[model samples]
Target chain A: MDVIRPGSLQDCLRILKTEHTIPIAGGTDLMVNLALNKISPDRIIDITGLQELKEISLSDNFLKIGALVTFSRLAGKEIAQYPCCNALREAAEKMGSPQIRNRATIGGNLVTGSSAGDGSVAILALDAQVELTGLDGIRKVPLSLFYSGYHQTAIHSDELLTAVYIPIRPGTSSFQKVGKRNALAIAVASLAIYSYIRDSHFEQIYIAIGSVAPTPIRAVKTDLFLQGQKITSGVIKEAARIIQDEIAPITDIRGTADYRRKLIANLLADQLQQLSESKN
Target chain B: MLSCKINGEEIHSEIPSDMRLIDFLREEMNLTGVKEGCSEGECGACTVLFNGDPVNSCIMLAIQAEGAEITTIEGIAKDGKLSDLQQAFIDHGAVQCGFCTPGMILAAQALLDKNPHPAEAEIRHAISGNLCRCTGYQAIVDAILAVSQRK
Candidate 1:
């Protein structure tokens, strides 16, 4: 095995163009797999040294988070104070444990494409765009479109995810997850909701559900049903029903299919109710 | 070969690119203080200070630690005297079975380093990763809190 530590992003991109390299950020996920011999690549690209990809900046109505930004950074007070970043911050805080969060990067979590990944669910709700850089060029793909299948992403083998861009807007967001244990446990079902409201009506709403589908997915049907609708117990109950029908949950070691579906609905309804109550 | 500052010592050694940092530390460098409870990232028994931040060494590659500053449990004491935090642990009877002490101490140290006066909730959140099947966590939390109060 060979490891190449690229000093600059350009050097890393150049290496990716020619070598069959696997780019590792914090090595929280990849290193575990490598240790178990689950994955073996000819060359490994250590991109952690590339300071260019470790930034978190907000500019031009967009919050740009570099791929190397760790979960610990996202959970910091500076990022958590923003309303637009509430769901992301909550997800980051709830993920893994302190040690794992210190080393796990948002890019690694999204690139893993796990339906139960807390970051994936929150980012999907935020309707974020992922910036993929390759030898060809740079392309921004919506988070919803980035996942091709389970544990797979639209990112080409040679392409590296550089940054995630989220449109910053004044919205109330909530993230909720039900796991077997409070700390260091995978979510049985998770939900994230972000809404822009005017008066008592929702101007726009984005809902993402995780651990109930093959990938972290936006509840488009439910969102459309609730958009521009007044916040009421009736509307919220109906929306919960729609969400239950929208998600395709499966039974796993963490939970049963029926249990996950019900959990998602309850979580969504509870979040919407809280958002409504907080608005008034 | 990789060159890294381990426990304040700048050392160079031929380490495999795929070897986990915990394995390299225990096998190559003979630092068994970093225990391996769960090879997966779920257990924080292998926690270490990577560049002043606590991280699980079991899930990090040795190559990834190249040029990084790491502080293990052995590095906590100086001149054969235990640090205030370690001494507090013993005084508070925080050690039980002693399996999780190293990682727990390191995690608590990381917290106290950043916030000298962390609230009870903050201290609990800081060591949420480190699991101790023995102490039920009351004494460990008390030990860390005592250190914070002393300072």
Candidate 2:
């Protein structure tokens, strides 16, 4: 096997264009895949030296995140306290142990496209967009349509995900994951909610769930049903039922499909009730 | 070739592109403190301080350590003396099987270095990656708190 440490983002793109090389960022996911023989690349491009792709900044009402930024940075003091980063921060803080978080990058998690990835589940609710760069040019794709299937994404083999952008919107966002244990446990089901309450009613709602489908998906039917609806116990019940009914959760060792539906319905109801009672 | 500072010493070595940092440290460098529990990131027995932050070396390539400052269990001592944190573990009976001691000490050291004083929850969170099946963790937490109280 051969590895080339590209000095810059331009160099990485150039290498990707001419060679069948896989890019390695944090290597938190890629290394595992390599060890499992899931993917064996003759040439691997180490992009860790590309310092330009390791920034997190707020620009034009969007929280722009570089693809190489690690989970530890996301859960740092400043981002954790940032109002626009609530859901993302929460997900980072809860996703993995310190050792893993210190090395795992947000881009690796999204590119891995795990159905139960906590970080991706939270980003899905934030209504984010990702910038993929290639020799041809750069393309910005909304994350909602980025995933084509389980562990599958629209990122071309020749393209590198350069950065991620999350629009800073008004109101609050939250994330929670249910699993057998906290550390080193994959989520049985996870939920992320972003919403605004106006005059005791729901204005805009984005509900994203993970480990309950082929990919982390937004609850389209549930979101449409809850828009402009008053927050009440009856409404919460209906919303829970809709989310539980619409998702296609699977039965695995972590949890049964039926158990996942029941747990997620309860999770959605709990989050809605919190939003209803919050002073925001 | 990887050129970096290890335990305050400048070092250079030739390694394969796919060679893991843990393998290099143990086999090539003869620093056996970095243990491999689960080759995956789930188990933190191979935890090492990459620029003072705890990271599992098993999942990281030696190529990634280019110009990086790494601290393994061997680096925790000062002037051939075990640091106060290591002594605290012994005094508090925090070690039984000793498999997880090095990683736990490094993880705790990272937290205490940052905070100088950490709450019980923070201590727990710091070593959450290093799993200790020998001690029930009460003693380990006590050992860390003992070190913290000294400051």
The deviation in Å at residue B141 for candidate 2 is: 0.9
lDDT of 2 by residue, B1-151 (tens): 8999898889998888789999989998889988899899887889999999999999999989999999999999989999999999999999998999988999999999899889999988888898888888999999999999896
CAPRI docking class of candidate 2: high
Per-residue CA lDDT of model 1 for A1-280, tens digit only, reads 8888887888888888765578888887787788789898888898888787889888998999999999999988757767977999999999999999999999999998999999999999998999999877999999989988889899988889999999989887879999998789899999999899997888999999899888898999999999999989999899999989988899888889999989998998899889888987
- How much native contact recovery, as a fraction, does model 1 achieve? 0.82
Please state the error at residue A32 of candidate 1 in Å: 2.0
Highest TM-score model number: 2
TM-score of each: 0.97, 0.98
- DockQ of each model against the real complex? 0.77, 0.87
Best by DockQ: 2
lDDT of 2 by residue, A102-177 (tens): 8888998899999999999999998999999998899999999999998999999999998999998777899999
Q: What is the TM-score of chain A alone in each candidate?
A: 0.97, 0.97
